[model samples]
Target: MPRMRSSSVIPHLLREQANAVQLYLQYKGYHWNVAGPLFRELHLLFDEHATTVFETIDALAERQRMLGAAAAYTLEDIRLASTIPHERGLPRTTQEMLERLIAAHHVIIEGMHEGFKSAESDQDPGSADLFARFVQAHEKMEWFLRELASEPPPTSEVTGRSSLAREKGVPAAAIPSSHAAPPFAGPPLT
Candidate 1:
């Protein structure tokens, strides 16, 4: 195996570390603040994404340490170096939050591609593998979020509608108006 040149990869590692930190923080923030019709789904998605990003952060920092370079130790360090900007405030809606997440993942995925190439050219197969894994994970997360946001607006001119009810050999209008979550049979209001 060829040796890794720390000089050629440490900066890339540091940038990835910073981006991970930023993404983790952003996911947690969205997880806490998410609301509305898709609140439960978005909240859970954010939490899962936060955990994944936190793991990536640890892996990246460890990579830096293994490379004999100091990893970022503070949000200040991350903020200064990260390409993803911190959220200014809570997003106005779940769609906005999903859009924001997709954007952040885009930045990270682009950086991961860059880092992977650098690592490969530097003859560091381990670092290249790590970058590839993160890229895959980020791509999955981006796809899920984008799918959630891809649904057409309720009022849009959608023709030839196809839905679960239609597939069940029932007309769309024949479907119940409210599938109100099994009447929330958990507990009674005080």
Candidate 2:
């Protein structure tokens, strides 16, 4: 049996586990329902994400057990504690799936941040570390989904601007210049 220190961590752990489970289910739903030109890629990616989330569910539950808290194990427990909204019907388009996933990632990230604060407040470094890991994972997943929905960085416009700038004798280095100074021959400064 794990040693008991405080009760405050239990609620956060329960909520985190529930959220992880709900997100895992949502990813599985997307894996099954995703369709369109990107079907193969999306299908494999969603399945991989679902598996990753399933592993996270186990980790969160085990952490709760380590903290001497009872893990939430039932669908009802997840439904009640999770803020992730489940779709009753499957999304019809790749875009719809991506949008839904982006939303879910944001929800999970917020929950993780809140869990991190709660754990830190309770002085539980282990729990806080777990929550930080959750935050990083969700943020990376969110970036992946966002990339699917994103316009291709307006590549045409960017290339056009650079080409035009070059035509006008602006060096390529100056076209998308950062804070670094331009190369120039000058008298040595003291």
lDDT of each prediction vs. the true structure? 0.77, 0.73
Off by over 4 Å in 1: 1-6, 153-190
- Candidate 2 has a TM-score of 0.76
Which digits, one per residue and each the tens of the lDDT, describe model 1 over residues 28-53? 99899876555677789899989998
Backbone clashes in model 1: 0
Question: Native-vs-model 1 lDDT?
Answer: 0.77
